[model samples]
Target: FADPSQAYDEQEASQEEERDGQYFEPVVPLPDLVDVSTGEENEQVLFSHRAKLYRYDKDLSQWKERGIGDLKILQHYETKSSNCAQTIGSLPI
Candidate 1:
């Protein structure tokens, strides 16, 4: 009887070679994108720190974690107003 495992191995090797020989082109060529402004371009970062944020939950009666992010304090050049910016990773708790 033909070995089933050997057949599978040969099939896998053929598939790998087929994949290596294949050349795929994108259906639609993507154009280069211009940089988008975040409205803080005129501001300068005064301080930046990585912090974990938490919020008090009334129903759960405990502090739930908000997220871990880089907290930045920025000062505008003209207005000299300080603005806080946070970049968080993970889902909201």
Candidate 2:
């Protein structure tokens, strides 16, 4: 038997050609880390370099920022990498 992913690859290719070059773009949004941990008054902040725990708030529909007083700077980096084995590919799974 051939490699298992070969058939899967062929199927994907066929689908791609049939669509006349339109492709599915992954809709990965920036994780909006919302933290009012430094209290509700301070809108501007410099985050600690070591802070890592994140809290998600369902009611407010955002993440509550922690380690506010400890952070030195806020840097936003948007990076993408896929671990196919762990990916929930073609969702509606």
Model 1 alpha-carbon drift over 4 Å, by segment: 1-32, 90-93
Error of 2 at 36 (Å): 22
Model 1 Cα lDDT, one tens digit per residue, 1-93: 999999999999999998997889999999999898777789999999998888999998999998899888999999999988788863322
Model 2: pairs clashing at backbone N, Cα or C within 3 Å: 34-63, 35-64, 35-65, 47-71, 47-72, 48-70, 48-71
Q: What is the TM-score of each candidate against the true structure?
A: 0.58, 0.24
Score residue 91 of candidate 1 by CA lDDT: 33
Worst 10 residues of 2 by lDDT: 84-93
Instruction: Please write out the lDDT profile of model 2 over residues 1-93, one tens digit for every residue.
Output: 888799999999998889996768779977788764522132322343433345799999998753222223332233222111111222211
TM-score between model 1 and native: 0.58
Q: In terms of TM-score, how similar is model 2 to the real structure?
A: 0.24
Candidate 2 ranges with C-alpha deviation above 4 Å: 21-93
